[model samples]
Target: MWLTSKIKQLLMVMKPGVVTLNYPAERPPVPKNLRGQPVWDHQKCIGCGGCSDHCPSRCILTRDVCQELRVMLYDGSRCTYCGRCADICPEGAITMSNSFEIACDDKDDITTRLELFMMTCQRCGRCYEMEKSNAIDRINLKGFRYDNLEQRALVRTTSETFSPELLKESDNYKRPSDKE
Candidate 1:
């Protein structure tokens, strides 16, 4: 009877469990809508301060200092794995990836700054963000929407008689020869 009991215990021990995982060697399946790592699409980003605005921990920051357009920065360390940024991104420029590894030793390494040089707006007297301008132009480049410049601006580099629009369009709309 003891031998039979020992055999039964051995059979139970050999029985397989519900699930088994072979990680790294075999790629594990990722669930749908899995929020992993965050990805930034620079071109789509308008720097409108939407993503930075929604961050709960204030890890993301954007400053249009001196009207030089938006200078954006993101702190991955302070971020609490919340999808607020990815959800609030106006241009759909930010997305969460499937990578959870973010180990870092230095605290400063968490802070990431992405600086963009913008063409100043001559009208608003404030620099028209190139990022915004690019987004606008890309939105409508049919050579028809002349009023597209309404949203664009350029910082006055020098006090010239040229309107920012004229300067920009002069190349396309050339001046008539005064020879007549």
Candidate 2:
């Protein structure tokens, strides 16, 4: 019975219906749903750090390379291809690509680098923006001009009005103590 079973196994192994491919020579068939690698678009990115926060392996690194510029580094070697980064990006900056061939001698080969310029408030000298984002630019372009002196004065007043001391000084502002 053992000899018959061994013969049957040999026959199955010798069957011509088996499908095989030479992997090194021919690219292996990748599934359509396969999330292979994450690609970063610096132009679309707003330096939000959403990808870094969502990354499971902690492959994304956001560092202040200089006072004027911020750098975001995506280390592919540490990535798990989880696609969380691509999903969580508010600006749609990150995307998953089909290219899985990331083998390299140098670690930086697969790294994606992005730089964002810091925008400072002209009046207050506060670094309000890490990057000159499109949304803010659009707002400014659509009538809200920060370069206008009147607009700047309005912004300053708006910010100062939020302060307790400033609110106390304002005739229109009534604090809880004043109301009591």
The local distance difference test score of each candidate is 0.53, 0.58
150, model 1: CA deviation in Å?
Answer: 35
Worst 10 residues of 2 by lDDT: 143-152
Per-residue C-alpha lDDT of model 2 across residues 35-136, encoded as one tens digit per residue: 988888888886655566456676675544334455667778778999988876778788898888889999779878777875544653422223435552
Q: What's the lDDT of the predicted structure labeled candidate 1?
A: 0.53
Choose the strongest candidate by TM-score.
2
What lDDT, from 0 to 1, does candidate 2 have?
A: 0.58
Estimated TM-score for each candidate: 0.51, 0.61
Which residue window of length 10 is worst by lDDT in model 1?
139-148
**For candidate 1, lDDT tens digit of each residue in 91-150?**
788888776766789855655565554454446443222343334222111111111112
The TM-score of predicted model 2 comes to 0.61
